[model samples]
Target chain A: MATATIAGADVTVDEEGFMTEFSEWSEDIGSALAGQIGIDLSDAHWKVLNFVREDFQAQGETPTLRRVSKVGGVPTKELFQLFPKKPAKKMSYIAGVPKPHGCV
Target chain B: MKRLLILGAGTAGTMVANKLRPRLDERDWNITIVDQDETHYYQPGFLFLPFGGYSRADLEKPKRAFMPKGVNLIMGEIDLIEPEDNQVKLVDGTTLPYDYLVIATGTSPRPDETPGLDSDEWYKSVFDFYTIDGAEALAKKLETWEGGRLAINVIEMPIKCPVAPLEFIFLAEAYFAERGMSDQVELVYVTPLPGAFTKPVAARYLGEMLQERKIGLEADYMLEQVDTENSKLISYDEREVEYDLLVTIPVNMGADFVDRSGLGDELNHVPVDKHNFLSDAHDNIFAIGDAAALPTSKAGSVAHFAVDVFTENFLDYIEGLPMRGEFDGHANCFIESGRGKGMLIDFNYDTEPLPGKYPLPGVGPFSLLMETEANHWGKVMFKWMYWNILLPGRELPLPALMSMAGKIPEKVG
Candidate 1:
């Protein structure tokens, strides 16, 4: 099992590689990830996060990478550097969605 | 032997003074209004100023000209409000005692609250349509602008006429289109709200309208500061939104005298009873318009309706009767949607804006939440009504209270 501590909240990765609790994920994680990727979690980032969450809630599914890239103005390569995996999974993480299987 | 002192000879105070002047016995009660400026601005006309639809002459009138004949209008800076003595001191060290005090100092645009917003780029790159000066400057800037990315940003919530920013964008789009430069401009609406508006149905409808007009919606954008040198609006988290032209609705604060008087909240807005418009800090003190920390939208229509209710209650207080809670937070706004079309919204504390005919119900000349040319015309005509009818304290044909009679209420599933 892999465990990640974000903003003093322990996020545990189960044997199947999914986060146990999504609500535990904090904005600090978004900030930390942004720092790691050499990006700032700015008004623009929150705007994108809110938009993605809204789109997901409306459509019952995550938006494609192209749509997020277009709306967020963040390049796909930059997004990958921030997420390091599936964009949907990263969006889920950023948007505080419960981790799906095979995502650490 | 009660003396009534009204502060600020603006829309709200003027209305209060005029409405009560004839009602109160001149020999028994004395009324005085104090303000620094002599000019009364038709604030709604500020929106049209940026587009050359209005001028300084069209927007301003002598403060005393519109006031009631009997009400004493004193032009001077307010030094402080002495709640204990029930008197307002002027900057000249003169004190006027009052049995009842009405605070209508209104709100001010504190552009300095946002870092670098008031820098050299202000009215050059960053502009606000909320002020007459800002509007005039923006007009000149827009005239020569070749156009690129234009962003309308709201720093925070509880701004005057919450929909004015959206209206500005819509009007700008229409303005550019009229000049055949619409294609050269990329319009973006940036706000701290979760969507285009606060109300759910209005937000959804307004969001769709933005999409239709090809306007970008940057929601939940909490502005941390303005990077004027870099031409970027930076959020608290450091996200940067680049813009060629920034139309900002700055942080609005109540009268500074409120802070000096120790009678205001953090934002300097007076704490008042939501329904009755009576200041909780002092029994004799009342607040209306942008000065009061009311839950209603800080718009002219809200002030008009509130003063209407306040007029009734103030009369009762004079007669030594109990106050009636008649104000329902009734707000009516005409939202311009561009291309000679607009939408009218009427709602109150309990009711959300519903779609249907307005005023006349089934046979209304105006439609609510639905865009129509007639609504746009109504909005345009209001400038005249504001000066001729509303400001003079004349009785309007329509009721001050919000009516759901003509609206088709949305059924909640």
Candidate 2:
């Protein structure tokens, strides 16, 4: 287990820096995680993250990339632009959800 | 009684084994195929892994499952080949002697060959889609990716699936468009070739596709090193292309054991007679697929076609008869252009891909060098054909050689 300090609070992260618990996830933590990966979150980024978080709470699993675009009302290209390098993992990381399976 | 030992039970090796099993008599002949692992990957499926359509199970199966019942399958690391002694030494201290040896150990992506390519940011920032792991990793990356400049680069040429990088860019364009963030990602195709593709006619056609898609073309760019610290590709000619995310197809080289055996070229490819695939250095050895230094694309279709010719020639060689079959270097590929549209290209060593119909003269279910939905379906259906018919050594409706029947002759300029 690895721990990252975001806004002076310790959050548990997996080996790949993915969040270990949803309870530790906050908008501020998401912002800090984004800063570490060299990105600044926008409203659009928040919208996707919120959708993923809500979807996870309701469904008990990370939302598929396709569902985020098709049902979550975000387009695929914008989702990519928001997450940059790796949208699915990065989004799951910031959203404080378990890393998506079958993603690697 | 004699033995035929094959190295690397991959695409070419598996096909050869299946095709030869029924032809060779068990009482007088024994066939053995060796590979480093039990898993046989449908490599073409790797290209689709980054996208949603294909799954991991769809691309992989047990190698022995596809191998014929009579052929012996040995899974171990290959140490060296002592062709003069008619034997191969395995890392586990197993020595297998063969009367005829076939090397089908294919090419692999060598990211380490490029400086800083395998650095700290490998799966984090820089990525490749050539391998299953790489594709899966990229799939995770693409999930919430806010795009910037997406640089799709090829380190060098003679790569397996030469058109794959182009296909990636096309699919990326469509993916971005479908996601409604089309304006966010700027697609750039960086290649060592001057145009979009290797063939002139195909290059012209594919080049237009890039242009129409608004993807930037950075042609004739020879990679020198990956500036991982800065997230940019610095070419040998001092050209630099910055990117937010780098998707590269690294330098592909034949297996290292080929180099150790002293029977390979500078790139570790075994030099073979282009027609019959007989090793230039040894009469009893033949190298097929990406291992052979054939003057054609390093593609599955080429391996399939070559196997068709080699099957006949190989039977004749062991019987002390002159080989009559000459491989014409026939190859065909379906290029996915996204939006449920794709293109087909069929050519050989002597011919370039021209605009025409395939398998028939006037009417074709598939068109060549032109994008069509039918071509995309053909591209999708090929996975079924590859596993069920092609690997089992079943006969296909297509010919092994390129035909001039439906092709339009090049007009004099």
Candidate 3:
């Protein structure tokens, strides 16, 4: 399993998505993933990313865009900009869910 | 040369403008609305604002944005209403003559009505969620606060959205729990109402919920004054409740122009027939929403229903026909209880909230007087509906009249 840093939190990822531990991540891998999705590891961005991940974990399913919007207080468009491809799937990816079928 | 002039571009005034704008003949009759401010606030959303659930932008929009195209939006303070002359004087020294007038100028929070409430502790320990500023400020205070005794006080009765206090308490519990500070924070609810709610069944249910959540209840406490220096709210007969943080629903009073015009009752609300919504003081004038002293809840649903009736009645008057004695004082509200669940209540002048199925009879997606996750979704979804559907003068799928189709009839003697 490979790992990366997203929004200052260390995260592990396999061929599917996020893995469990921060220790598996390297600085280069973290910066590459951050570059793939144009977002800085700012505190505000971390707050939203962490909240969405936590909400998905508690609900045991991926959250819809509106649910993420309400809890994060971030506009859907701005949230979309942070995760260019399949924001919901990317949220799930960062949240440690297996990449769903048909998601790149 | 007949014209209609409406005052205050809040919920009530905006509804009247939209409802009548389509019905009135633009060539023969002109419609004008007046208000000092430019923005219209979605008040129900204000309850969520203090919890970082909403921001100022989400709660407000340009008042003119929602107003119908045919109506003239007059942005100015109303200096006086000369009812005898059928004229309204604006602060800009302009006199507007009207053949008929609709006073929809709603109420304002009077925190100063209680002694020392507006003192040094005004926005510090003591706060109100009625205004944008108050809600935003309270949000900041709630963020860092570790824990202490937190009291939600209703200074008196007849405040807009009566159930908001209870919602605040419910959401607060969820908020503290989310922040892992639930154990440190103590919750108390103080109100003049004899029970946790106005109705019996809901009251008992909500009161028990309060207990379950470890929230203290002090009912029938008529507030005398705020002893700010000591951080205590004192009641008549010298009873006192101390709080590290005090959130209050201040005394709500009607429009200032009503008092200026001497056309209102003790609280400056216009006297109108409780059923008909016609001004008792004048034949051509009408009042609706919170401005009208109706013996119903001062709520958005009430205004929506009242405007539905007012539209029909006004059309009858224009055609020189008899008025229909409709308007059953119907009001429906969804109460948010946090933790992804909520309760729905539907009642009117003659009926109180009773447990039953709603809108679909036995197959309801919503249950009255019962808490459910679907009801919570309904409450959250309403904000979108308010902005896109309700405010734009669009007709919704739901009927304006309260229906008993989903409700089981109460057993009677």
Candidate 4:
């Protein structure tokens, strides 16, 4: 049981530092979290974050990376450049969506 | 009565027991299989656990279920093998004498060997998918993890399932996109080899796949330590790669008893003739599967094919006749790419994996070295074949030796 103060709001997280409640996420909260990880969210980051959040809201499941590359209009190579490390988990964190089940 | 005692009742031992039970006369010969544990695991299932596709219940079964009824099953840890005395001593001070011995004990991931790999960060920020517990723990970690540099490093070479790391990263790419986080994570592959794989052709082909997926490959990396405080992997050459989450395949080695018995090579793998698996030091002892030091990839397919050849040669050797069978070190593996597609690779000791049809030369339902949905299904179906047909020692239509019938070798450049 861990909690992080983000954008003046206390958000719950698991031991691995993943947000426990999607409802507690906000743009300001994501920005605050991103700042801790040494990232300043640009338009590209928001584009993926918003798309993931909307998809999770509608389908109750996150879209696959292939889906993001093909349907979300982001090229595969560009996705790596944007995320720079682990894009799926980071994007879900900022978008206020749950982590994809199979991504490591 | 002659007693044939086999050590480590895993894949190779179990198949040998089942294959020889009826072949040997019950009156003159006694068969016994020894293992430290009663549980048998479908090891390939470990790959699917992190993906929410498998559970402990799906992969575990009783060891006795696969062992033939006539073969005696002994549950005890092996302490040492006294090849000079033709006996094996158990941890509990029991000695089993054997006229012929087969060692099927397999290799295991040894995170402890790497400095700082098993530190406080293990199972927290750093994890391995080779073990069931490690895979299960990672499943939970991935549940809530916000992405960072996900570095998949192979600390050394000669690890089990050489293609598995590639499959994992490929599957990860698909898994991340499915969650619409393709832009939030970076994928990096660090290896000790010079390329994406061991063989030249396969390495070049797989290296391109890595490029297509945008996964950075840091090849020829010899891990020196894991900097837990800073979250980085340091190589012997003083190079460093930082990561938020590190999934690694640690150094793999054979059973410790092999070392204790003074029957092992540098990695504790028993020194055996690559063609027959007969121990170079002892004519009556054979080491098969991951336990043997063969110049081929350590995989289930290799064990199956080796077992096929060893069973025939063993019969001849025990009867004081010339052994007729020779193993060519054939191995086949399915590479799982994301998006419901996969690729297959088949080769032997002399040949590198080449692109062509497998089994059928001109008209294969499955393509080799190329991605297809059919290849994915083949991988899915292999689990069934492993348990029922392969373990039970039932005959498979595939040849034990590598076939060049449909293989296409690259023309001289």
Candidate 5:
């Protein structure tokens, strides 16, 4: 892991730039992380990101897109529209949580 | 008398019973195993069923035959697992109480969970090789298939025997060639993973094999639904892969009783301490096998290794002592690469599968991460071992924890 400046906040990140510390995140920091990955945070995007953040806080792991829709009251089709392709990875990167491990 | 109640008489449940029975004295411990059926499927055999390699006799046996002679075996569908009362309710109105509960119902393909998957085209064009019926249907389909684009899609990750889909494609590649129709068939391996597998070295090794056989790899696909009307797979991101023969591994979930018990994750898998398979919530409840949300492959190899650790730790737990075993998440798989050639992979939680001789350093009868004829025989011989040695709880020479002794570690891996 390495520390980097994102949105002018010091944060630790893994080799793939996924946030190591979930506590080092704010709405401004999330937007900066989103901007780096070419995503603009709309209310729709925040709707998904916020759910992922809160759910991860509760479940203690990154929630899959299916869980966000099924348990968090968001439709899967809309998540695709908001986070676009690769929502699982992109959402985790912006939400400042560890990316979901490809559980073998 | 103290009671030990184990649910599901599949690979894990059966193994747990056999391992614990001889150790837990009959005078003091009363062990009872419950399941919905009597037939114990040699699940690893299911992969070869599509190729007409085995019949019902070779793949199945009575669960009673393997019981350790002292344990009680109950057959009935589970209605609910009442963890609070420490009892399980069967659909037949029988309630079996236990001092300790082991949930090992395992996971199964839930095609109905996805739209249009279990519909009109099921067993007609779209198929799944995870079940006996599906494998038999696929076998018949292959017998006279006028080949076209054959797409093997994995609907989700953490599916049982994750290598089976790749093995299916490999066997299909060789099977079509033997029929003098290699050109007539187009094989595509579609998965949500970015490559042939989750691990780096194995994926590269397996990915290269796919390229050599001229099979297409469609990766990073998370399915939204199966479009039965058009005979195609529609991904969540609007990507589409049209196919003629779709062999899909639909979303695999744990038993419904787990969900009803309010003791499961989103996928209905019981949350547990990974090292010991102890329930995160209730102290008396433990879930082993695919029923537990383990971070490793849900293959029989994992169940075997995990059961070994759980058995030892369980012996201590009942005595009110701390579990001394820290399970390393050891798992191995034999990948059938067709034409009497297969590959072996061995690894644990901290390590990815690497190339080396397995079980013996520089002198393995079977090799790891490289396809060979010996590996194929190892897989074939494993069936005999599974019935005679593995499920019966007889000791195998192999260690429960993974060792790097035979492995040649490399930076690239």
Candidate 6:
């Protein structure tokens, strides 16, 4: 775990560049994190990112793609379109949530 | 008298009951175990059945045979668990009240969860070996299946015996080779994980093994649906894998009654404290085996190890003493890599499998993370142990928590 600057704001991040502190995340910081990964933050993308952000707070862990699809009301196909390739990892990265675990 | 209600007399429930029956006074506690089926399946044998390694007869026995004499075995389907009322209702309209409840209703492979998976092609071109019927059907299919592209796909994860997919593909390669048709048949493993396994060291080792065998691995493919019309699998990313025959490990979920009872996660697995198997919502209720949503492989090995720790802690809990045992999510599995050789892996929640000997420091009759003939024999011998030692709640020679004694840790960059 190390401190890194994103969107001109300082935040703690893990070795994989995922933000460690969820409280350090904001709309501006999120957009910059997305920009670093070559993805622009759209409302469609925020829907997933926002859901992941809030769900992590409540669930005490990251929500799986199934949970995002089933409980968060986001279809998996569209999540793939919004984030591309690996939506679960990318969405959580932008949302400043821990990497989703447990065989998802 | 305090009634102890145990649901689904599978591995965890059976072990818990057997371990406690001899200890709990018959006068003070009324122990009752409920299940819809009377037969207890050797689920690990299901993987071997597809390879013609075991027959259906070798995998099943009367559930009551393994249970203790004093415990009441009730055969019925669970309709609902009213946690507030501390009672469970059966499908036959009988209500059973309890002072304590244990949900050992394990997870199952639900092929119908995925669309086009349960349609006309099911058991014809598409198959699953998770269930007894599926395993038997697949065995017959393999007996007559002409050589073609055989694709094994894992639709999702947290499936019981997570390593079975790798073992299936490996055994298939050997099976086809034995029949002199290895040249005609192509094997591919389609999985959601990015590599051959979840852990880094084991994944690298297993991934190399797959490459050496020339097995094609389509990684990180999140399955969306099966297109039976085209005889292909469609992913959420719009990638399609066409195959002559498909063996699928579908989305696994816990008993539906868990969801109906409102005491489960999205997959219907009960939310339990990882350390003690106690439910997060209710203190008196506990979930063991695949029913508990622990961040580990839902394997019978886990259930056994957990029952060991749970038994010790439970004995303390009933006496109003502080429960001492803490489970480390220990899991040990044997991977059949074809031939007469197999590999064994043992680790806990915090530690990944390392290359070493198990049980014994260096003289391990079993080697970890490497293939050996002894490991294969150890796996074969486990059947007798499961019936004689494990189910009877006899103490295993192995420790409940993982030990780092024999392991030589490697530094990977």
Q: Report lDDT (CA) for all predictions.
A: 0.81, 0.88, 0.79, 0.86, 0.92, 0.92
Candidate 4: docking tier: incorrect
5 or 6, greater by DockQ: 5
The C-alpha stretches of model 1 lying farther than 4 A from their native spots are A1-104
Give candidate 3 regions above 4 Å deviation: A1-104, B409-413
Cα deviation at B4, candidate 5, in Å, is: 0.5
Consecutive 10-residue window with the lowest summed lDDT within model 4 chain B: B264-273
- Whole-model lDDT, candidate 4? 0.86
| Candidate 3 residue-wise lDDT, A1-104, digit = tens | 66555656566666555554533444444445555556455565565567765665664444555456655576555555566435655655554444322100
Clashing pairs in 5: none
Listing candidates in order, what is each one's chain A TM-score?
0.52, 0.91, 0.54, 0.86, 0.94, 0.95
Clashing pairs in 1: A42-B239
Worst 10 residues of 6 chain B by lDDT: B404-413
Tens digits of per-residue lDDT, candidate 4, B1-413, equal: 99999999999999999999989999999999999989998998888888777888999889999988789999999999999999999999999999999999999999998889979999999999999899999989887888888999998767898899999999888888898878988999998777898887989999999999999999867677899899999976668999999999998889999999999865787878889999989989999998997778889999999999988898889889988899998999999988999999999888989999887896777788999999999999998999899999999998999998888999955
- TM-score of candidate 5 to 2 decimals: 0.98
Model 4: runs farther than 4 Å from truth?
A1-104
Reference-based lDDT, residue B395, model 6: 85
Model 6, range B162-238, lDDT digits (tens) per residue?
A: 99999999889989999999899999999999999988889999999999888999999999999988899999999
Tens digit of per-residue lDDT, candidate 6, span A1-104: 88898888999998999998889999999999899889988888888888888899987999999899999999988899999999989988989988888771
* Prediction 2 global C-alpha lDDT: 0.88
lDDT of 5 by residue, A1-104 (tens): 89999989999998889889989999999999999989999988888888889988987889887788888788878877777888888889999998888467
Q: How much DockQ does model 2 earn?
A: 0.01
Q: Say which candidate scores most in DockQ.
A: 5
lDDT of 3 by residue, B197-293 (tens): 8776678888988998999999867677888999998875357999999999998889888988987765677878777788887887888888876
